[model samples]
Target: MNTNDLKIFEAVVESGSFTKAADIMFTVQSNVTARIKSLEEEFNAKLFSRTSRKVELTEEGKILMNYAKQIQHLVEEAKNEIISNETVNGHLTIGCMETTMTLKAPEILLAFGEKYPAVELEFKSDNRDSLISAVLNYKLDAAFVSGPLNISGLEKIKIKEEQLVILASSKEAGLNKLLAKEPMKSIVFDNGCIFRERLESWFSHKGIHNYKSIELNSIEGIINFVDAGLGISLLPEEVVSRYYQGRNICTYSLNKQLGTMTTLLVYRKGKAPSTALQSFIDMHIEDIA
Candidate 1:
């Protein structure tokens, strides 16, 4: 009947079980069950069908879920609008790709934090796909991505263009030439990484599809793995240049045919940017341009 009920419903759907949702929401399982029951009663329809295995959404629940999403979005917008007028003070959640978190983002964030110390900044670093989803779900105010992005319902502002390079340990000489000898082994972030996806697509396009992947979750892990001669990876030139100096990594530019992926500052369309967030983005735009 209220925002809390909508949040409970959304959490339950995402977590896939009432008990799990309760744990996430920091409430008892019965409380989660009661909230869902209250919501279903309010709609005069069943929202979920529970089985021994898992909970599934009923057809009516599907419809309500969509409405609930809109309701939650509007409520948050209202709250932000009210709080934004008081001062440029509130929580700002940003989604970042691992590469950006290393160097470029820090300078901009440092300046922003100093300028608006009242604004609390929270960052979530993950793969590109999840960042896009976070923006779509209103979980992040904005995100920085390496692209050409395929995200819908968002505005993509070109921040800068970064060259993508194939990198290996400095000790491995002539490995770039050896890429043709066999499908290269790669140390990759997960499937959601834009660079990882781009590299795979490039390989598939060139009829080189037999590479092996070592999956890791962080940029530090990738750099360390590549430093140990585990495999090669593709990253923005700026990111690697700042972080990999004297770290036993050698880099070579990808072919000109692959071009460069422009780095973008992305946010959902039709939403107003807060003063602090706008100022931060404007600073980046000014500094870059």
Candidate 2:
């Protein structure tokens, strides 16, 4: 029931190792282990399945991690609000994809900061899957991501639409024809990316199987490899425009028949949004409308 114990548990989960968490907190590894043990004893539930190499969260541990994050977020928000006047100040954590960070967020972030200078913006950028998990875990106040996000216990609003495109080195001609004929070499984000999922589904439906795929973690890395003629990739049109415009890349629409994917603004349901969070969402609603 002690908040400090929850924090210690959270640190262990986030750091993925007691030794690493101890190092982060400038404490001894044994101390961190003792805190986790105390918490497990209090809850009468195991938190982690520990091995020599790695620590994996049990189902109970995963549930506790989610609640711990919520408690941490609430504590931070309370302090920030109490310290502020009639202004939006304090930390505002947001999660976003690298592609969305490049294409969609800069102008919005700039405008929001200008209007609410007291607010401290904290950003976490990664693939879409991690972004969703962060928001769900209360590590983020909100996130801008591509959707039909169907996660339980979350609220979402469709903010915009973006097209997914297949790109190759512009010098490498006839990519569109090649895709129709065979699956060309592809560079993609890991399997969790929506574009990657959609692309895979599209190929499967087309009965195309003549492709090799490489998984890259970053959008920039994927584009770099594609531009070097290492492979082709499917990316959001806006991301392609921002990163690969005027580069040796050509884009083909991934079948307008598939329709436009929605970009969503998401937050945890039932949790009241802070003034700053509401303000940010309102601005997007106005802009998108």
Residue 95's lDDT within candidate 2 is 85
lDDT of 1 by residue, 231-282 (tens): 8888877767776687999888777656487878898776666666676678
* lDDT (CA) per prediction: 0.81, 0.80
Encode model 2's per-residue lDDT on 145-224: one tens digit a residue.
88777988778988878888877888776765656645467788776777777777777776777878898888889889
- Candidate 1: give the clashing pairs: none
Scored by Cα lDDT, where does model 2 land? 0.80
Report the number of clashing residue pairs per model.
0, 0
Candidate 2 global TM-score: 0.83
Give the residue spans of candidate 1 off by over 4 A.
Answer: 20-31, 180-183, 202-207, 257-259, 274-276
Once superposed on the true structure, which residue ranges of model 2 sit more than 4 Å away at CA? 13-22, 27-64, 180-183, 257-259
| TM-score of structure candidate 1 | 0.85
Q: Which stretch of 10 consecutive residues in model 2 shows the poorest summed lDDT?
A: 175-184
